[model samples]
Target: MRVQKIWGADIYRDGGSYGFCFDSDDGQWYEFFLKTRAFEPVSPESHQPPIIYRNGCNSGEVVLRLSWEEAQAFVAPLRYENRRFMELIDIVMTSGGTARRH
Candidate 1:
């Protein structure tokens, strides 16, 4: 499946994590979360890092995990949009809430 667009992205300073939302080719929208530490590689050959997503079962005890490669494929088509989201995040963070984007 391909990503149509990234609709939202945010860095949670208090939680020390990042989250993003995107639409897929199947006409479904997904929101996923990742920890800051996930960006660090466990080994040199580790390419498929994991990401976390809240489970929809309402149990508040489970999470769905996906690999980095899988996440990459999900956002490949809309890579530029993801990049823009990150850029906006950086600007907002560095500017101390003086800048905004929508």
Candidate 2:
């Protein structure tokens, strides 16, 4: 599905990035990830959403932070929600939430 249409209902584009929170379809209490797409836009003044971050990282973890940033850092924004993205995102979200690993 087109990224915009799939989650556009809950997504917000700001500056050069697009972001969304893990809100349920009911739309409530969604803990948002600030500036989740860590890309520097190709078109600086085009107003188009930026691409995803380079291979995704936590931008160098601190003594109190993991390199993955607990999903706090915006990874590259996905152009399409393909299966690979699903799997990777599952890993990201699970690890971020400190949930039981599969």
Give me the candidate number with maximum TM-score. 1
State every prediction's TM-score relative to the real structure.
0.45, 0.24
Badly placed stretches (over 4 Å) of model 1 are: 37-49, 52-64, 72-77, 81-84, 87-102
Give me the candidate number with maximum lDDT. Answer: 1
| Native-structure RMSD, model 2 | 13.7
Candidate 1: global Cα-lDDT? 0.46
Residues 16-78, model 2: lDDT tens digits: 222232323343322222233324444222222222321122333212222444342433454
lDDT of 1 by residue, 1-102 (tens): 455766777655743455666566777665555444435555332122334343311224333465555554544444444543664344323321212344
As a whole number from 0 to 100, the lDDT of residue 89 in candidate 1 is 45
